[model samples]
Target: MFIRNERSIKEFIRYYPVVSTIIIIHILTWLLDIIPIGLFNQLYHLGVGSHWGLQNGEYWRFITPIFLHGGLTHMLFNSFSLVLFGPALEEMLGKAKFLFAYIGAGVLANIATFIIHPSILYSHVGASGAIFGLFGVYVFMVAFRKNLIDSQSSQIVMVIFIIGIIMTFLRPNINIYAHILGFVVGFLIAPLVLNGARPYYPPQYRKSYDDDGEIRFDPNRWKKKRFSRKTKQNFLWTIIIILVVIGVLYNVF
Candidate 1:
């Protein structure tokens, strides 16, 4: 007899909020490409490869490159992976912390790329470096929580890393160095990002049972919970909208 042990759809959804958000952004970016507006393409041109490395200027390129993309396929693949990995990481680290980690890793990856290929005028785009960083973080988390060599997660990550290295050597356009650097940085930062997170517990079990058999988890019963699904959704949407607006503005002006 076959036994299905899949998680509930709701549970799957909860584990992938960040991933869904990234996918939405990717779809939006793709849509912008087909629209009559020339804004997204223009914004992309300005954003990528705008950093200064050993050069005398263009210092902002280090951070701006992460927002850029070379084409629809590039953005789609990168964003898909982001969605796959980002939510899991974010849920573990909290949305705010995850955002910081993503942006920080992306910026650092761009910097590393710029340092390595400073004089290349060609624009570098896509979220590969940042996504790779998240991969690193995932691997690190799994390794920390389980056996490094024997764990299925760690083994899978190792295979991915090996494949990435091989692809880097095989492909002329791939940014292998950036991927490597981002992975290292993400792995290094995972522990810090995940510090002090309460161990996984069911929602119902999260509440405390006092000696009197009453719920005693609340420090101030009068005060509302600090964070919830609604709060997280609102915060996520706000950031997405702001980023979209910025992209639009960049295209128009």
Candidate 2:
């Protein structure tokens, strides 16, 4: 279910426009943040999840921080997680439902973070909360809707989730409240959104007919030669793990 089969960047965007848009926003926001323009600096400050901002009725901080990142590492990790897992849920739940779940979880997580940490200096950023919300949806499926996800994918989800939680505590400048709250919100809302949801299916290739009136099928006409799907999934997870280790080391040193 986590496999991505789009043949090109265009196809990938067309197939999963919601996820694509989110990643694009993440990149653009990060770029604006790093730029030294005065207005962009105000944009970053206005968007950060600051307790003072929330207390002063700058409520949009709850939603805006989801697209903001503290650094390149923060944005890349969250964006990669979205790219790795967002497409399947987007496909299964349809665009509207998936978007609601994602943004809802993020907003609620920020609210919860504000409630739990009332200090005026407290602030955080990144899409980790919403990404954890996605994990929450997968956790619900693995526990209650087993038929929707294969056992292998279920195993992957559980393993990655455990690692994520561990890293939440280990990593510096992390928002523990947002991560946990986002996950809880996602799990709680899963049943409502997942109702009548279907399993994700990769893009299909059309069949061709020979001149002799026989139908011929090229199983991989649209797909390029690459690792088997199972291998690809494994490799993807391996790269995620490596990235996680690198992040940890970078933070430590």
Candidate 3:
């Protein structure tokens, strides 16, 4: 989707302003820590940060804090995830839809954390929720949109996704629910973007995959151009449902 090569990096910066701006903003936001102490707080309260207080009248909280972070590691992990997952999703959906999905997932995930894990002294900050949204978007596409990713690649991606989830649970200080909420939001809305995005693949490539992810094609199934909407719904819903269940149980016991 996005080439990490030097030429492609320049292209992304020039062409993909939304994603580029997001990456830039997140980096600069992390650098805010180097500034004086109370200065960050002064800037944080201009109705940009999301917390339970968002419901009281701070509407911009839905979008602003997507740029903020907690520490060097927090910012780096999220920035890496965004760079990894964002380009293709952004390319597939176009800039507007891409940005909408990013912010939408972030806002909803923040709201979930606000509702479910509020604290007076602590705050939920970071782009992991939004990055997880991109994470889910990629996973949903690979699973349901046949040949959007080949079987072997998709299997590897799922393994990586599972590991990320496992790591999320290991960090008790983090708001895991926010990540789940963002993932679910991205999964549900991916189909809408797919409809608008043009298809990409090698025409010579056969549509082939067995239940176990081995390449076993049925001619009847391959004849179709793309999977049906119902198929997309079923696949993404099942993944997110399983994820949410695991997250809930993790929090509970």
Candidate 4:
């Protein structure tokens, strides 16, 4: 299920460093193609299928392929989805758990891809499989607990999935099989990850009290009051600077 309230961008960035790092890697890979050192090329080669499958000695290709993307569009779209879904999942599950889920899902997705298309030697890349896993977790978390996912957010996810399906049919080069397989695997595995996890409490549900043992009914009093305006402004500017740095790195090597 999706978050009920809009998370502040700052809060999101703070909780999702792994997501941000992966996106940065995608952008850097694209920008580094302009360099002549062949570093990006080397990484690309290392990340591809590499004659590795269920039969090959290099079985790691099942997982490594998720970190590689064929082109700028592939990288951008996958990274965008990661950013959209990563933070919420990370917030719900701790960073370490989220990371495990992502990598595990990626590996499973790659294995499925290899099993179905063993003879095809195309270099596979992008975070779609992992994103699919995140979607799987989201759907599972919500479906099992209807209160977790609000109606609006559920509709949004459905719309996105529909769009993805349409794009799969329209785009000849798109790997619809991989996407479907990844999604299925992710959905199947999410419940296991969430087993024994406690239900999340919305911020609104948490109440504060006064020294007199009276419940503080004023909503404004519940708002975070520690930070001064100047402090908040400085933090906002800092976030802006960080975002700018990420954008620059995305565009240039």
Candidate 5:
């Protein structure tokens, strides 16, 4: 199990430069902090959270916070999660969609944080929000396409999600809302990003169990609906509906 995933991660990163660049940028930011260079340090501070980052016309901060970290430990933990889950997701969704989902989730997480806690005047930094976004994609994909993974893998994935959510509450000074909102955005937008990217069951696995729970493998009994381009278009329509509803609510007096 681990071996296959490891091989896939390597292949995914080798073929895709976006994930590698993100990881490198995060590491470089950490290194920059330790080196204490004047100009590099000055640019590094751009990622540190600011309440008016969006309002002050420094819109980059919306996405930059996902690369910044509070400390070495913070960076390490986030880096671990990123490499563990980010690559496969990028492979599944394709680079452009994956990048959009990540940045979009982080931006919404930050936006939600501000709306929910307007008085909390502290600089936020960390990739946990974006990491949780990847986690969210994993969860949604698992829910939609259970045949893609085994039962054991699904159990581990659920346990990780449960433990991760619990940790957000147990740890102080952590923005639980950001993680939650990131997850929500990831869950909602993943279907649209997937957009016909789901893996289909093979011909041989189309078998059914007997009344006493006996196993059989038949190659001809095909019953599942085809996940075609029309299905992808329906998901895109759902995304549009959701966005239109949210926009109306936000702007309506």
Candidate 6:
């Protein structure tokens, strides 16, 4: 379920519009921030998760920071995480429910951050909270709703989740409160939205065979071979390793 089968960016977007749109927004806002025109400086000042802003009734800060990032590395890391993880949930929960869960987790995480850090100057940004929320949903599926994911994917989720939790504590400037609370919120909200949810199967790889008495006729043949389960597992593990290296580098620099 964690494997991505899309051959191109267009196909990826077509299959997973919600994840695509969120990533697009991340890139756009990040571009705005770095454009050197100072046009979006107000966005940085107003949209960051500032306890001061929340106290003064700028409630949108909760939602806005989910789409904002502090730098290229910040945006790319979260976007890569989403690209790797978000499609399965989007496919399982449907677009609307997936959006609800994502935004809900992020907003609640920001609220938790505000409550946990009472100082007026405390502020945070990035979608790490929301990304952790995605991990939370996977954790719920892996633990309570086993049928929703396969054994391999569950192992991947648990490994990544554990690594993520460790990194949350190890990384400097990390918003521990947002990450933890977002995960909790996602775990709690999973049952409400996951009714009738099923494991993800990419449309392109779906095939059916028609039985003609003793022989089966395969009607849907593709020029390219589909990925083996082992191949996908290896690829995912490679990504996990790369993420670990990146996380370590992030801590160093």
Structural similarity to truth (TM-score) of each candidate: 0.64, 0.88, 0.71, 0.71, 0.72, 0.91
Query: Model 3 clash tally?
Result: 0
- What's the C-alpha lDDT at position 61 in model 1? 67
The local distance difference test score of each candidate is 0.59, 0.87, 0.68, 0.64, 0.68, 0.86
Give a tens-digit lDDT track for model 4, residues 22-58.
7777777666554567776775666675544346577
After best superposition, candidate 1 residue 209: deviation in angstroms?
10
Off by over 4 Å in 3: 1-3, 37-41, 45-52, 118-122, 199-253
Write candidate 6's Cα lDDT for 1-253 as tens digits: 6767789999999989999999999998888788777657766667788888889999999899999998888898899899999998998899999999899999999988888797998888999888888888889998899988988889888988899999999888889999999999999999987986877767677555463434222355334556765776789899789989988887787
- In TM-score terms, candidate 5 sits at 0.72
Superposed model 6: Cα runs more than 4 Å off: 207-229
Per-residue alpha-carbon lDDT of candidate 3 for residues 40-152, written as tens digits (9 for 90 to 100): 75675553454545656776776777788876666766676676567666666788899988998898888877777666454667787888887777788787886575564
Task: For candidate 1, write residues 139-223 as lDDT tens digits.
Answer: 7766685521234335445655565555556656767767888887788887877775433222322345645633334455325
Q: Candidate 1: lDDT of 79?
A: 65
CA deviation > 4 Å runs, candidate 5: 1-12, 200-253
Weakest ten-residue segment in model 4 by summed lDDT: 197-206
Worst 10 residues of 3 by lDDT: 199-208
Ranking by lDDT: 2, 6, 5, 3, 4, 1
Instruction: List model 5 lDDT by residue over 21-80, tens digit each.
Output: 788888888886777678888777877767766556776777788888866767766776
**1-253, model 2: which lDDT tens digit per residue?**
6666677889989889999999999999998889999998888888999899889999999999999998887788789889889999998899999999999999999999999889999988899899999999999999999978988789889988888898888877789999999999999999999998866656444354444633345677537646676787778678667757866774675
- 2 or 4, greater by TM-score: 2
Q: How far is candidate 2 from the true structure (C-alpha RMSD, Å)?
A: 4.8
Name the best candidate (by TM-score).
6
